[model samples]
Target: MQLTVFPAPTSPTANLDHGHDHGGCRTKALQTAEQLCNNRGVRLTPMRRQVLELIWESHRAIKAYDLLDRIKPTTGTAKPATVYRALDFLLEQGLIHKVESLNAFIGCSFSDHQHQQLLLTCIRCLEVEERPAAGVMEAIDRELEQAAFIIHHKAIEIHGICIRCAKHPPITATI
Candidate 1:
């Protein structure tokens, strides 16, 4: 098989790191979702909104079944399909991101804007933080271009101890 290379883009412009009001993140995300859906002529259905809220309940990535379990109590009987559909809608609207490796979902930090960034998962805390490294994305673009390849969807996941976790000792299981 032959290899290919591509040309990349520019420098790093933003950092989605932690250290702010998490509630603010959720509020902004919901507001942004509302505005974007309205602007795009799409409806921010109740189910989708609920899913977005649950995902934004924390910075950690959560799985589909977990979402279903959480919603069933509130909805009185949430089907797998309903939760999945809501997740699909949120993902399509860029309100949330699917952590491919973990098969879980996390609210996107750059939801208001359009751009894919790095997902840093804290092994100890299980919190996933978004970091927009334009420099790194540029390099990926360059590599893809050199190979004459078209991009479909992309996500870079890095798993390790986050700053908070790194500062503290590892979390041990109760059992």
Candidate 2:
């Protein structure tokens, strides 16, 4: 078997790392966005940045309707298609990922390149956790080998009650 070698671009943001630091996260994401758009000769419009920022603030999968709600007043009663187009651009740039199960999206926690999004949804608090599935990804590679399948982007999502919810049950049974 032979391996392919790809040349690297001259953008600095391509080396950013993904972690739980929001300060670093936002700064890095913005810088990365600029680098990516500039490298591709595309404009990352202000409105697009605003929409992406809202999604990042939540750190969870957000529905299109939800995004529309947040962007409406500022964007002057935004239409669904408009928001969808912005989302499409973001996804195309690998800046975000759509959660298939929830019909929602979250900011791509990875910085340098588009990384596989792995979500851990809390059944009780409805909080979504994003992390790199290094170990699980390796396991999937082995499993796929056993089945003679080639896996592309690794998506391993698990839904369950979080520790806080497990210890303290909600009174109203909210999601």
Candidate 3:
């Protein structure tokens, strides 16, 4: 099976930062999640809302344990199972994606559309940018048909240094 990988630009002017109105994005995402749950006859619980809010706080991939830590203050008795359950719910509803390479989760920028996820992860800064890989699903389906393979889940992560990191490396302390 042939997979097309797009390289992130290394130029200084390349908009490596996935710029979005943070507050607006979060509001829209929460609204979308609520609508999706309502339409599917599922409840968007308070804990789920908290978890989604934490995930949308940044565009970077966040680990489950980290989420658990963050939610502890509010939900004093929060546990791993609780976070995992919320994460699973979000994933099922297409509200978030798991970054396989980083073993972390990121909020889906385009949750309304059904498409294969193409993630660009920065190795240095750990920033993740998601884009839709059109035709990728069809291509994979065609290949799977030829090989008689059944698919379960799919996540595509492309790792490379981001433009900011490339332009300015972290300064090391010299003795």
Candidate 4:
């Protein structure tokens, strides 16, 4: 028998269904990352910056190899290890998040500060929206305390149909 465990459900509704200014969001995230890296005395190398840019290009979770392939056109002879190293650096600096469930990465806007969050992935569009679920995280912490458990890491990924998709699904052509 196999056992599968899923994270607890998050907030009931989607908050990013409306028009999203991805241009502004991308700029802000890159600026914040640069500032954080500068403050921490860390180098946001060109490769790392590129990786972060790719992650922020869409709301969807992206795998490392996908990053590698996407980067190859601009960066010649890019290797998996090189991308992984950049990913490690980004993860260490909290500039990006690794969505374990999807085995992918996503940029974090609140990387400058420490906070618990949950990712709401749209099943239809495959877009991932990050939401700060303080209440849910607090409840989890309480449960952990009661269980006398120590948390080394924390992240919650909830998969469902986003409001945008639910409200206005893509029109399919008749066969």
Q: lDDT scores for all predictions? A: 0.81, 0.71, 0.81, 0.81
- Which scores higher on TM-score, 1 or 4? 4
Q: Tens digit of lDDT per residue, candidate 4, span 110-164?
A: 8878655888888776778888878898899999999999999987889998887
Alpha-carbon TM-score of each model against the true structure: 0.84, 0.73, 0.80, 0.85
The collision pairs in model 3 are none
**How many Å off is the CA of 94 in candidate 4?**
0.6
lDDT over C-alpha atoms for residue 125 of model 1: 64
Give the TM-score comparing model 1 with the true structure, all chains together.
0.84
Put down candidate 2 lDDT per residue, 10-96, tens digits, no spaces.
122222112234555666777888898899998789878877877776555678888898888896969999899889999888888
Candidate 1 residues lying further than 4 Å off, grouped into runs, are: 1-20, 171-175
Per TM-score, what order, best first? Answer: 4, 1, 3, 2
User: Distance (Å) between predicted and true CA of 56, model 3?
Assistant: 0.6
Error of 4 at 7 (Å): 27
Residue-level lDDT tens digits of model 3 in 1-175: 4443343433322333445446676788899989989999998999999999888777778899999999999979999999999999999889999998888998988888764578999876667888776777678789989999988877778999777667765555434
lDDT tens digits, residue span 1-175, model 1: 4333221111111123344457777888899889999999999988889889888877878899999988998989899999999999988888898999999999988887756889999866678889889899999999999999999988899999788766755434443
Give the winner by lDDT: 1 or 2.
1
Residue 170, model 2: Cα distance from true site in angstroms: 3.3
Worst 10 residues of 2 by lDDT: 9-18
